[model samples]
Target: MKKKVGLYFGTFNPIHSGHLIIANYMVEFSELTEVWMVVTPHNPFKKKSSLLDNHHRLEMVYKACEDYPNLKPSDIEFGLPQPNYTVNTLIQLEEKYPELEFALIMGEDNLKSFHKWKNYKVILERYSIFVYPRISKGLIENEFLTHAKITRVPAPIIEMSSTFIRKAVKEGKNIKPMLPEKVWKYLDEMNFYK
Candidate 1:
């Protein structure tokens, strides 16, 4: 059987525990062999000014994921063009790692805007999607919920945010609870997000 890998794409401005929980839950509860956290260079919907440099974000993810054997930190987008889109990224990944069958992983809240994603139809038709939940939107019920391509994993809603962590960091507050020990230490030593 082909290796089943779940791609959890995010900016990971700083990879926190919430991200690990979701990625961890997916691997333990689903058919995925491993969950690769794909650090995005930039998000079209988000402000570029608010983002840390892609290399920095990528390194932080590497630090955060080092302890989890099944959780990988990927810089796939670093080689892609500016203003990258998901469809393109997926295409390139599949081309490069044709031996692995890829699945898309996202939170339930993302389902609210799933249709707006570029080439979403092709994505749903070709790959599987694992949807985890967030604290605010613990569950989602819709026609898409019944779609064969989508699977709602019963993972607990993680109640943390990178924004909240960043704010706490800037205010000189300890955010150990939201981050991995190594990542928190790295951020503190580097004086990042201040």
Candidate 2:
């Protein structure tokens, strides 16, 4: 059988326990054979100034995922053009790893706004999406709720946010418990977000 890979895209400004938990859960409990923590170099919707250097963020993801055999860090988006779109990345990944069946791992919150994404319909037609629960207020598009390509996974709802983590670090708060031990050490040594 072809290996099934779930693409978990994120900036991973500093990968935390919440991110690790979801990726680990998806790989172990879902149909995915592996979960790739795709470190996004730039998110078109977010400001570049607020993001850390891409390599630093990738390193953090690497450190955070090292202990999990089924979890791997991916830099595939780093070489892609600036302001990359999900559809484009998916196409590239499919071309490069034709032997693997790739799927998207997203939050319920993202699913609510999935329709607004560039070429979202095309994405839905080509690949499956694995949605994890999130405490979101808005309504998911009724169509997405019943879409054949979308699968809702019963993963724990982790409310932790990278934005909150960055704020805590800037304030010199003890955020060790919020991050993986290795990630915490890397963030501390580098004095990021302070």
The candidate maximizing TM-score is: 2
Cand. 1 TM to true fold: 0.95
Worst 10 residues of 2 by lDDT: 42-51
TM-score of model 2 (CA atoms): 0.98
For candidate 1, lDDT tens digit of each residue in 1-194? 99999999999878899999889999999999999999998888998887888888888989888888999999998899888888999999999999999999988788768888999899989999998876553445465779999988999888888988888899989788789998888888888889
* Over 4 Å off, model 2: none
Quantify all predictions' global Cα lDDT against the true fold.
0.89, 0.94
lDDT of 2 by residue, 20-44 (tens): 9999999988999999999999898
RMSD of each predicted structure? 1.6, 0.7
lDDT of 1 at 63: 87
Using all chains and alpha carbons, the TM-scores for the candidates as numbered come to 0.95, 0.98
